[model samples]
Target: MMRYSWLLSTVAAALLGSPATADEFGDPEAGAKVYSQCKGCHQVGAGATHRIGPHLNGLFGRPAAGLEDFKYSKSFQRAGASGLEWHAETLDAFLENPRSYASGTRMSYRGLKDETDRKNVIAYLRTFSDDPANIPEADPTATPTDHDIDPVILAIQGDPEYGEYLSSECTTCHQASGGDDGIPSIVYWPEDEFVVAMHAYKNKQRKHPVMQMIAGRLNEEEIAALAAYFKNLDN
Candidate 1:
């Protein structure tokens, strides 16, 4: 089943290009504080024991819906089966909204209305786990510039090749029009709504054992790519 999932995801990826809005992102420090709300259910350290959700050690650059140990919702499993990667822009959108990102998603969180807060939370989160390195090293020869490179665009907008490679894991569930037993069908869902659903999942305000597990796996960029890919699919 996992092998077949890879096959479908490859085909789906061939149809789409890399995302264009990955670079616009914010602070990891703030993301850590925001994560306090999440500690109630998740563990972000490597080699950490699974709590209500699976451990989120290397969340950035991971495949969408790709935790082998966690029992995901039908929808998420389906997404993984289909082939998706959790890029930065995708994460931003998902954090902004979840229910709309993927219909039938079990998460119950509302979302992060403030963009700055969302970016800060994401920034802070990078420091906690292998989510992503939001802070880039300063080049000594160049001007000392702390210009905020939008993480969403940096992660998603550049090259489809990396994104394609990352998405290879989602096909495990999302490729088929009708999902396997536990996974849900996402081919028919609305694109914009899919973005919203991801956000609800990330905010932790949403409540669903499976969704919490899946959302906890993502950062910001991965979420954007996943949302974009699904939005472009034909039902």
Candidate 2:
């Protein structure tokens, strides 16, 4: 049998319908303070070892449950196998709720709900790694300004009912429960903003190839509809 838990996490974002973070993170200094809450279970900075949690050195882009010294929950290891990379957005969602991100994970502390604390903690952790390349240079939340968006094309509002019908394909990766098996949840988003994001994917403004492919097939109306459908979902 596979060493994986078959249990499913909730099909909603960890913050229970809060908007996804598409903005800049908080100060690392502030995060270091917020992380005091985490010190009981985790350790960071120089000579940090495996405490209640694994040392998080060079965590960004590192695969989940990557440490050999610390035994991770089978659920976490399986999640790693499923391609969960610890990028900024991924970290953001997971920090919002660990158990929701990976059901059956052994982590016991409640997730950090403050977006600023989450960003700050991730930023503070970014300082632990020796390699600067492991850290992101610019804020991941900032939308690219290079491309001009079509206001006329975007003017159309989507039909949530039709979008709900079209959303079957989207839920394949985005799991309706907002479970983070390395994918971001679109649940509880602003409809228009969600359309703008999908259009970014369609225009190759966003970098992910899979999203580009998925968004490429959607017309402006379909994108709007799906956005509306998800926007109306209960958190």
The candidate scoring highest on lDDT is 2
lDDT of each: 0.52, 0.67
lDDT (10s digit) by residue, model 2, range 1-235:
0101101111133337644344454567877898898888888877889888898777765778888889998767866776666666667756766654565578897788776678788777767655463223422321112233467766787888998889988888888887777666668876655776677669753445787799999998898889889988864
Per-candidate Cα RMSD to the true structure, in Å, reads 14.7, 12.7
Pairing residues by index, what is the TM-score of model 2? Answer: 0.50
Candidate 2 clashing pairs, residues 3+ apart or interchain: 11-177, 11-178, 12-177, 12-178
Model 2 stretches with alpha carbons more than 4 Å out: 1-23, 133-235
lDDT of 1 by residue, 1-235 (tens): 2223333443454557633233344555666788786676667765666677656666555665677888766666655554444544445555666555545556666777677766666555455444225233210111111222244433443223443454556556656455546555555445345444555566542345566667678766666666566645554
